[model samples]
Target: MNLWGRINTLRNQIFLGFMFVMVLVLAAVGLFNYEQVSVLLRSNAEKHIQQTAVQATGKLDVLLRQIDTFTAQVATNANIQRLLMQEADGRPINFEERQLLQQEVRKHEAYTTGIRSIELYTTEYRRLLPLADDTLESRVPDEWISRVDEGKGRLIWLGLDPRYPDVVIAIRHVRLIDRSFSHAGYVMVQIDKSYFELMNAESAADNDRAAREYMGLVDESGQIISSDFPSDIEAAALISRQETISLDGKKYFAVQKQSDTTGWKIIILTPVDYATEGIAVLRTAIIVSVMVGGLLFLILTFILSVMITRPILNLIKAMRNARFGTLKPIPVTSATMEINELNHTYNQMVVSLNELIEVVYQKEIIQSRTELKALQAQINPHFLFNTLEAFYWALDEKGEEELSEIVVAMSGLFRYVISRADEDEWVTVGDELEHAERYLKIMDMRMLDRLSWRIEADDASRCVPIPKLLIQPLVENAILHGVEQRVGQGTVVLRAEPSGRKGYTRIVVTDDGPGMNEDKIRELYAAMESGQNDSAKGNGIGLANVERRLRLYYEAGTNGLNIRSEEAKGTTIAFEIPGEQGRD
Candidate 1:
């Protein structure tokens, strides 16, 4: 055939065939490029989040600690006490001394560098200015005085400053400390937004030179202490980024930090577009490259007829068979590892679908987790409360002081069951002792009959906050089932001794009352393991709730309850709860 006739014969097949080959080449290249780009982008994003959170926390800790240290020093200053002493002696500062004292107070304010306002307040409703030439009010606010009333010598952290926006902060009311400390007044200092800038490492520059980022200093109340975001951005309803909030008509990714000393929450916002912008760039690039390649293939359509058409047809057939689970390889296709490997992978995916489908459906898995939390909520609180109310009503009707004390014990029991503190779940052993004492005292008040309770706490466990309400419930439960149920004022001995440094706080509550028999003792063990209720013996929800919270918060191997009982003898409930919810 002539060249023209050959070209005409092949034109229809060749046109589409060459185009198809070009498409294959483009797709393979795009896939390779996409994989590399995606890995790098994901890795970078993850690292950035980890690094920023770590640095921000460290910086904040140092800043807050410095403030605390300075505040402590000022609290104990001799001159502050001297002025307080003179007032105590019914001697007032001479006019010059008053001026010097005022100047000194002003100097302290200046030294603070980040304080917005400072004032001296007296109960006589008198106000004095420390900085004599102050640009703003030197007197205490009406509310500040009310909060500081007679609360001298103690630090009272007040709420946000209503006058300032985003600059809401934590204020401490310290009554003058010491016997000679006069009731002259309290010093109120307003913390400034710039105080947080101390965390910045740069040579202290004008605030304008600070980073062009949205930074905020929050006090314990979770209000913004200050922010670099426009005042308008601050106006957005304070919402967490983990939730969603709109800004400037767009979304943003954000993070939050709750301050340790003040309980303030600091939030940082990044434009949502900024967060997803990288993904958008990669997506756009891939699409554009594929489109450009596809257009280029259109120009090569009129060449390479039979060979190209055969391979392309086989590729489509192979893809179809792989998807349909037929594993139909194109009979006479390209001899290429890449195409064959693609077929192999597709076939394996189909083969494994039965096994992997379970993973894909998360409904049951998530439902179980949710149910576990719900179960905990249901079992712990409900059992304790119902039993306590039952006890309280009995006390009221019978004029039984014994019942009242038991009710009090029951109330404390509930408190401990539910109280999860700000940072730790458990309170200290000493706190446990205090709560247990309250429980026992209420019981003693009720029984009126003498039920003696003794506590022996090791020196170290005094400050260790253990799981809340742990000690009392077991003690009261012992009283209810053992001591009070029997005749006479029962004796309950309480002891907590730290075994070792790893928060090994052991608590034992022993009662001198008729204890359980062998059958009943076995039942108690059964109740614990199965978490079943035993109405005959008083080891109901209080003991169960205490054990559950401790086990939930403490390290598994270290937490549980122990009970020893004898027929017609005494009973003791002993258990070990981690000193501080195992967090410390």
Candidate 2:
């Protein structure tokens, strides 16, 4: 339901593919938009921090100007000037004058907050006066005194007041009205640090807490003047010019501006995580949307793929069944038009193919019958051959025993050949041997002591059926071509036994006579291979026909004749037939 799982099936894979494409597109668009937004957000964050620093600096400028105005007012006060300028016979001022000067300084001190006190140092009188309650008289360092003396009338920041470290002092070398900017006495103003601290506190409070921001102020020497940040952060901010930097391996965004009044840098530090928090939220939203969309897409893709594939799968099943001779028309149920058309075409092909098969089968039957009748017509020579048998028996009745025996054998041979005229007829090896024996007898009388024959067949072989007259033609060939032309008596052997090849009987008709040369044997083999029955005198009854018929009956070339001959030696011709004894 959540879309994460194995995609092993076709529908699952298709669904996964759709989901994958969805994810890719969403990721591409999301990442691109996120990148752009992130850049804009980050840029805005930097500019915001910079503007915040500038605003803080503006606030600090106001406070610094107030301090400057306060210092200027005190230095120009008439009572304080007159008390410091009055010389009482080169001695310090009396208590009454001092009290009057203190009252004037108090007026200036009242205008500022957290001012510990105001004092006047008259080097000409060597007198220090403190102008407020809780104002202790302490020895001021000569460094501070000399700096104030060197300032002429310009105010000088004396760093932090040592006795009141929380306060900063500003001083101006006071000038008398003697037309001289000489070192008269110095007017010093003490301002509390809480003013600057308040400025920073207010600036940080204005920003959101999630921003994790803090501010710092650094002098021109990169020394911290006022801020709430840690020392390390302040140090890092002082040196860093980048809008963003890593603090202790964590990212931070920093921006700074220099105060026009104090020449101090105001820096704000915000965690990068805080700045890009919006981007993270946006990215999460985008991912969630993509997941939901992808799930919906996957469901839709699965449904569509199933709709498309189901009919095609059925068609495939039907086609597969067709391979095993199932030529039935496939049922048309495809939803798609093209697939339905394909199924229809397939159905037509099945019908046409079945029809063609039937037509071919019928034609083959007719051809077989025609061929059978043709062979029967050829065997119909039985009439003349049978008439010759009448003559043969008639001669036998005349009591010429040798002639009578020959005639009887000829009659039996003719009967055997005529009985087997039908091509479908099959005879056992023993019956075929008997037929060959009768033909040999006839040939023996014709050759007149020039031919002799023997038939050697195993009992098991004798029952094995073969095409009728399968051996007779080879026997006739042996006598006529092998013995009839020889000067002395030649022997013909008819052998039937279990062939060396399994499941077959080997029939060899060998003749010992003036053997043929290799050339004549080659010519006979060539004619047999070509299936051409050359009507040459040496090839009696055409050995090619006997070879072709043997091959056809057994349906194997190895079952056909093989002739082996040598000049002046002998010729051995052999063939094989099925070992089945029944007349199949």
Candidate 3:
């Protein structure tokens, strides 16, 4: 067998159909589960990382507040305020006041763990304390002084000291504590960068060090002030505002929290693989389950296909034996009810077929005898045609020309009606029309002025082939039923023309006689379809026979006979036949 034959078999079709349905159901369930779990895992990871960022920012804020307190204490000391008052009065500061100021600054430095230095400068940009590198003018830029003045006694965080390079700095404007609260000088505090590493240490203790998250601190401007992972600072800077980022072909989730005290942000970047570690195990489990289930299902499907097709195959074998004239019945072997019923039905069919064979053989003998009688009957028509020819000659000799033409038409009509056994059932449209015309001529002589007929056909339409005797029956039905019952003179017209449909020609038999109502026409069609002769309605065996022959000869889906009539108007009956190109 070919590929289609193999697939079309009962066994393979059942197996493949079940397998396809099972696989589709499994795939839909598996995909839905995987997506739901993945979303849950990622959501939990994001929430956990967000909490960690908030905690780290809070701790950093507390440390910064402590440094601010220490700076406040030094700036508010009475000795420092008195010294600034003396300097504003144009009195030079003594060596003892300078020593006291230096001691006060060093004293506050001991309060903070990461404090690198504390320095003070006059409004003129001259160093006031920490005289180790004494110079006439301080190295502090005027821009720094302007920014500090804008602080208005509040501490302003300046990320990463440009001069020191190893520390982050804060600057504040020092004001007198007395009633004036006057501007004195500027105070600066620098803290070492190692202080920011506390967050990393705490995170590493909570998680595995190998998969621990990296933390960084950035100023309001997104410039990196300090980070535990110094080498990744550039990548971290680019993604400061993003929740997740990709770098070096690896993905990371970024979490951020901004401090209210220092106006700085703490950023944490956790590797995506570490966060979604559980998803891999779940995916592997699902894949293995699907594979094992598919294999088991395939085996089960094969076994069931065999069980179902075995009995069917046995039935097919018995059918093949019947094809060879064995006429043997099959045994009922299958346990299934439907299959067993099928086997029982087949056995009954085989028994009935044997009986039918005997009956058909007897009928063939009877049909042969009937055909011989039919052959004997065919001789009468030839004898009749010869008698009619003799009558035509006698009438012509007696000066009866009209009656002679009638006799001649009758002779030709009888000859056309007699079909030879070897003659083709189909005839050209022109020949069939000629036969109908002869019949009409004979009827016209009987009716005198009561009936008239006309035929309309183009040359091409007349040459088309159609089943013989088809048009004449339609014409006969119209004249006998339609024109014969009319009160006045009636006209019957036959037209053969192209039907407008491809490869078809239309034949219409129309009569200008008393027509039928819708109900009467419907009843006429119903009688024709049921093969009943409606004698009371004047439509009998002739119309029914023509309708049956048209159906038998024409292809399906093409238009058949269409009858149109009204109570007062004439009736028109039209039907289509295949053209020359459509003929087999």
Q: Estimate each model's TM-score.
A: 0.35, 0.38, 0.42
Locate the minimum summed-lDDT window of 10 residues in model 2.
1-10
Residue lDDT tens for model 2, 363-389: 999999999998777635667777777
Cα lDDT of model 3 overall?
0.77
Note the Cα lDDT for every prediction shown: 0.61, 0.72, 0.77
Cα lDDT of model 3 by residue, 1-584, tens digit: 46664445454656676777578657765766666676667876787678778788778877888888988888898888888778766786877888888988887776678888887866665667777544223445566667778888988887777667778878887788784777887788888887765465556776565465677788776667777654744844554577688766677788777788777887887888777666544765577656756766677768776767776887687677677755888765554455667888989988998999999999999999999998887566667888898999999999999999989888887788787768778888999899989989988988889998999999889999888888888788788878888887889999999988887889999998788999988988997889876554555447677788788877573466689998767899888877853443
How much is the lDDT of residue 528 in candidate 2?
85
Root-mean-square deviation (CA) per prediction = 17.8, 49.4, 37.6
Ranking by TM-score: 3, 2, 1
Question: What is the C-alpha lDDT profile of model 1 across 1-584, one tens digit per residue?
Answer: 36654453324455567667767766766766666665556454444444555666677777666655555555456676566557546676566766666666665655555666655544344344453433213333556555556455544446566766534233343345676444545555666666665235442242336323345655554555555666766523554445446666766456666666455556665443343336644665567666766655555653453444555567676566555543433333245434455556655766676556666577678989998997787656667777888888888888987667667676875666565336455456787787778777877776776688788877776876665566766876787888877876779988877755475667788888888888987777777667666444544456667666656766474548878888677997777655554354
Candidate 2 global TM-score: 0.38
Ranking by lDDT: 3, 2, 1
> CA lDDT of 454 in candidate 1?
82
Error of 3 at 183 (Å): 99
Best by lDDT: 3
The local lDDT score (0 to 100) that residue 245 gets in candidate 2 is 73
In candidate 3, the residue pairs with backbone N, CA or C atoms under 3 Å apart (3 or more residues apart, or in different chains) clash, namely: none
Better of 1 and 3 by lDDT: 3
Question: Candidate 3: lDDT of 584?
Answer: 38
